[model samples]
Target: MGIVLNQSLKNTIITYIGFGIGGISTIFLFPYILGKTFYGLSNYILSCANVIMPLFAIGMQNTLVKFYSQCKTDEEESRFLSFTVLFPLLLSVPLILIGLLFFDDIAYFLTKKNAIVKDFIWLIPFIGLCMAYFEIFYAWARVHMHSVFGNFIKEVGLRFVSLLGLLAIYFKWITIVEFIYFTAVIYFLAFLVTMLYAFRIKKPVFQFVIPSNVKEILIYTFYIILSGSVANLLLDGDKIMLNQYMAIGNIAFYSVATYIALVISVPSRAMHQIVYPITAKLMHNNQHDELNDLYKKTSINLQIVGGFVMLCIFVNIEQLYEMIPKEYSGGILVVFMIGISKYFDLILGNNNAIIFNTKYYRAVLFLGVLLVLLTVGLNMIFIPIYGILGSAFATLLSITLYSLAKLMFVVKRLHLYPFTAQTLYSIALTIVLFLLFYFWQFPFHPIIAIGLKSILVTISYVYLNYKLVISKEINQVIDNVLKKLKIG
Candidate 1:
């Protein structure tokens, strides 16, 4: 728990800093500098790359995390690492060949609704391949319990570089076309840096022979491929589908709102970097009691952090939208729909780590397949009628359904739950904070109003959570901070 707290807190701060830069780029700079069309085009390209990344990696990222800790000796670890490292290239080679063989057909299919996408179609696979290896090496780093550095690169370095690229466009130092191409360069550079860092963390000892548990490793990787693809599809499918159904510019508008909502999930993302490997180790050791305690603690701590962010976003959404261009403001509803759904997703703690690491993961993969179909079906039915809002609705429905299913499976199969009295208390407090400050907008500029309201809500929320002791882990951190400042 001490290590979890230290690392999670560090990761949380880093993730928020990244989100801060990303917020400027997404909410203000991109829309103002590039206009909605180019902004959408840029985001659409990245979204396509993200959707296919899991396939290119062939689930090696998760396979490494799940099995690395179970190896008995350095020799066994070397064999496992060697195979996982090369497995993705085996899958990606055929994919690359096929992509080239059917290049024109694939390009035509993608650009039918939005011809602007035609020029950048080739970059998708290139960027996806880069992202896949980045995660593969990131997992290699995580298995050694060295996640903070990799996390900084993923969370901060990428966004910071992209900010420079966006500023280049603003200063007319580069054309939007150049900016788009440069974005791929950014991903490739980040990938190379992460790979180097991975080797630095644990110099790879390549033993290409099959591991003793090759059969189990292969089976788990196969199931993980399905599960990982399903997760990415659910997360990124909306933006991709929007390009298909509406004008490309609508994706820009939707991306703004989605990014705002995604800020609420930062804690989960930060914590999961450390928690995933830890959960795998715990499960491998069959430490059920500690695992159960971790489940509850993670759920509460994430709920505390995510709930505070969600409340701030939901309460201040109207004022926040005032800063953005009017054309993009329609996503206010999109923010709420997606924001609440993400909160639900967050409170599940390390539910994903639990499911993906356990044997029952195969069953969850089945559920993931169904939810992917449901998400697509919902988008198909809703988008034509509702446009981007409909896309948000489909995401909300799919994510909620998926979160509920994962929660149930973990409880039924593993006899573990992430909820307790503190869970409900946190929910109630979140609602109260929203109702209290949401309507209390200041009679000032949007920025000033947001600043004051955020302070009030944050102070009130933190004070109450501390008094009620909603999370002992968080309370401990608070106490430590107070002691360091000599204010307790």
Candidate 2:
């Protein structure tokens, strides 16, 4: 718990800083400097890359996390690490070759609705390959329990470099077309940096020998590929569908609004970096009681933190749209729909870790594939009629349904639950705060109004959670901060 708190706090700060840079880029620079068409084109390229990333990496990222702790000796660990790095090439090479052999057909199909995507079609797999390897290396770091440096590179370094690229466009140093190419280079650089950092943590012994658990590892990796694809599809599939059904520019609007809503999930992202590997270790050790305790704590703590973020976003969503261009304002509904779904996910704590690390992962994978189909079906039905709003609706419904299924499987199969009395209290608190502050706004600039309202919300939310002691871990965190300030 101490290490989780310590690193999660650092990761949270780093993630927020990254999201801050990304917010500036997505909310301000991309919209104003590049305009919506180019903005959408860039995001669409990345989204496509994300959607296929799992296939390229072949699930080595998650496989490393799940299986690393089982290695009994340095020799075995090195062999496992070597497999994680090299096995992806087996699939990636063939996939790349296929992409080359069918490049023309693929390009034509992708560009049918939006020809702007035609020229950059090649970058999709190139970037996807880069993204896949980046996660593999990142998982390399996480398995060693050295997640902070890798997290910084993932969260802050990439966005910061991309910010400079955006500025290059602003200064007329690069054309938008060049910036698009630069984006591919940026992902490659991120992979390079993380790989180096991971090597520094534990210099790879590079044993190519297959481990005794090779069969088990292969099976897990296979299922994880589908599972990871399902997750990424749910996250970015809406944008891809938007590219197909709506104007490429609509993705730009969806990107901005979703980015704002995405801030609510930062805590989960930050915590999961460390928590995932920890959960893996716990399950590997067969520490059921301890695992269940972690489940409850993580659930309540994230609920409190994520709830605060959601409250701020919901109350200040209107002003947030005011800060962006009016053309992008239609995504206000997109924000709430996406935000609520993400909040539901956040409260589930380490539910994903529990499922992916368990033997019943195949069952959950089956559910995930079905839900991915459901998401695509919903988008097909709704996108033509409702536009980006429809895509958001599709995402909200799919993610919520998928989350509930995962939650139920974990509880029924494993006899573990993430909810407790504190869960109910936290939910009630979030609702109360939202109703109280949402209608009220400061008569000032949007920035100032958001600042004041956020302060009011934070103070009220923190004070109540502290008083009620909704989570002993959270309360202790508050105590430590107050003690450091000498104000407790």
Candidate 3:
């Protein structure tokens, strides 16, 4: 266990550092620079690209992850990489044509505004194409356990480009429409860089040779496509739907709060990039004991980090809103609802890697489809009267329900549960800290109150964790970090 953490430490730390910049960018710059309309457009465009991404790639991102772990020799790895890339190129053809033909209508249907959506409709095909191949390249990176650079590119690179685009909009160098169109272009460039890095390392050959295991590859790819598409819908479908029903600017406000909430998502994603392939390789060998220990440790570690981030956002949300335009204060509910959901999602630990890497993953697809229908239905039922808050509520309920269903499926079928005694203690600490700080509206300035509450609550959380020690593995980690900091 120590060996695994030690090996992943450098890359994981780099990835987190990048995420730290990206987080502040989302929290401070996005709302401040772009405000809500472009914010919504930014969110809307990415959601659009995400929905189309799996379709264009034919779910090769997941396929690469699952299969790459199984490849034996250098030749096998090369052929697999070639097939992954070539297959997505083949799939993108039809998607590109369909995207071009439907551009006008998709824009019209997604928003009633005069060509706001229509103006940038042309960017979707290119964006979709990028999503497909980048994953193929990123999978090449992940298979070698070289995750940090790819992760930085995957999670942070586009945002950096977007920052440039925001500058163009701010300086009037590009109109809002152009800024939106440039988003798709930025993603394409990001993917190209990833491809360059991929070749630099592996020097991928574009030739496809049939593997002895091609049958297994094809079957898993099919399931991955369905599962990936459905999962994307579960995550991004709300933003897309909001673009359709509510004002596009509303997406910006909600996105601010969502961004605050999504800070918790980064550690999970960063850690997962390293952990998934490792877990898959371990599970492939029937190393259930190692896998279980990993599950508990990941939960505690993610919670410890994620919990603090959530508390900071929870306490500072008012100032966060104060700093943003007054119109965004409506997103307070978005903060609470989305923050809790993201926190819970993080606390699930490696449940996702465990599920997606296993044989029963097809079950996740069916459940995901059901989840989409429920989410859409709920959004429809709620959005008419509640507006933006309604959208947040719908998302919160859907994610919560989806998490519960996934948990039950994993437990009943695999007899695994992420929650344990320490899990409850973490939850208890979260509740106590939140109650103390949530409604207090301290006499101090907003920043100081935020700082004090954050420090005090974090201290309380750590002290309580010391008492229960969560998992023994978790206690050891705390002790080690404390020892490094000379806290002990």
Residue 213, model 3: Cα distance from true site in angstroms? 2.9
lDDT of 2 by residue, 1-488 (tens): 99999999999999999999998898889999889999999999999999999999999999999988888898888899999998897778888998999999988888888998998899999999999999999999988788899889989999999999999988999998999999999999999999998899889987678888889999998999999999999999999988888889999999998999999999999999999999998999999999999999899999999999999999999988898989998999999999999999999999999999999999989899999999999999999999999999999999999999999999999999899998999999999999999999778999999999999999999999999999998888778888989963
TM-scores of the candidates in the order shown: 0.98, 0.99, 0.92
| Distance from true location, Cα of 319 in model 3, Å | 2.2
Candidate 2 stretches greater than 4 Å from native: none
* Candidate 1 residue pairs in backbone clash: none
| Candidate 1: tens digits of C-alpha lDDT, residues 311-367 | 999999999999899999899999999999999999999999999889889988899
Residues 172-245, model 3: lDDT tens digits:
79876667778778788888999898888888776778778888878888777777777778678888878767
Better of 2 and 3 by lDDT: 2
lDDT of 3 at 219: 83
Report the alpha-carbon TM-score of model 3 versus the true structure. 0.92
- lDDT (0-100) at residue 113 of candidate 2? 86
Please give the range of 10 consecutive residues that has the lowest summed lDDT in model 2. 479-488
Relative to the true structure, candidate 2 reaches a TM of 0.99
